[model samples]
Target: MPRLLGVDIPADRPTIISLTYLYGVGEKTARELCHKAGVNPQARARDLQEDEVARIAALLDKDYTVEGQLRRQVSQNISRLRDIASYRGMRHRRGLPVRGQRTKTNARTRKGPKKTVAGKKGVKDLR
Candidate 1:
């Protein structure tokens, strides 16, 4: 395993694939970073030289907000929305879908397990 930007990437994978193990780094970004660092994208992570790993780490540190920092930033953004009382924020605060999806059905993922409501008794039983 090669550690890059505090994440241990799989050594057996190609550099491009391994780089995606870092948060906020996708396939396109990985390829671009490899190109910028003058590294072979097809090369395996374990095969990379120390200087190459250093170069990739340096590039990430200089230009990208990832992992903890990115997570914090996203949390802050949601908190800001909540403080402002936005509709989306309210949805988030309520633990419901924030994208205007109908809650009547198919929101099980956001709403969690169903809570069964007892049906009303028959009119004859009310006498």
Candidate 2:
């Protein structure tokens, strides 16, 4: 295993893939990072020299936030939404869908479980 950005990358995976295991690093960004650090995309994690790993870590620290930094940034984004009091922000505060998707059918995951409507009975209570 190679240590990059304080994370142990699996030995068998290529450097590009290994870097993505870190939080907030996706496949596209990983490839870009590898290029910026002058690391071969095809290079295996275990084959990486210490200096190469350090270069990669330095690039990540400079350009992107991972692990703890990424988490804090995400929390800050949510906080901003709460501050704005926009329609979407209201959805976030109420724990509903932020987008304008119809709640009639889909979006059950966010809209939560469906409620049974009493057909013909109208608004009558079952008791």
Candidate 3:
């Protein structure tokens, strides 16, 4: 594994794919980083020279927000929303779907497992 910006990238993968192992880096950004760093995107990560790794790391530090920095920035944004009492912030605070997804069904991912309430007894139970 090649360590870049404190993250270990898989050595078996192509440089482009390896770069995506970092938080906030996707295919498009990885491609762009390879281009700007003058590194071969198709080259295996293990084959990259020290200079090439330094170049990519320098470029990321200078031009991108990623990893812990990106995570903190996102959390700050959500916290700000919550502080301001925004609807989206409320959803985040409440752990509900924030993108207007209907909660009537299929929101199990956000809503978590069902908390079933006991059913009411029928009229026959009263007799």
Q: Best candidate per lDDT, number?
A: 3
Counted clashes in each candidate structure:
0, 0, 0
lDDT tens digits, residues 70-91, model 2?
8899888887888988777788
Per-candidate TM-score against the hidden true structure: 0.81, 0.68, 0.83
lDDT of 1: 0.91
Top-TM-score candidate index:
3
Q: How far is candidate 3 from the true structure (C-alpha RMSD, Å)?
A: 3.2
Error of 2 at 84 (Å): 3.2
RMSD of each: 3.6, 4.7, 3.2
Model 1 lDDT per residue over 28-119, tens place: 99998999999999999999999999999999989888888898999999999999999988988988889878998889988788766578
Candidate 2: worst 10 consecutive residues by lDDT?
Answer: 114-123
- On residues 75-120, what C-alpha lDDT tens digit does candidate 3 reach at each position? 9999999999999999998889999999988999987887665785
Better of 1 and 3 by TM-score: 3
Better of 1 and 2 by TM-score: 1
Point out the worst 10-residue segment of candidate 1 by lDDT: 118-127
List candidate 3 stretches off by more than 4 Å: 113-127
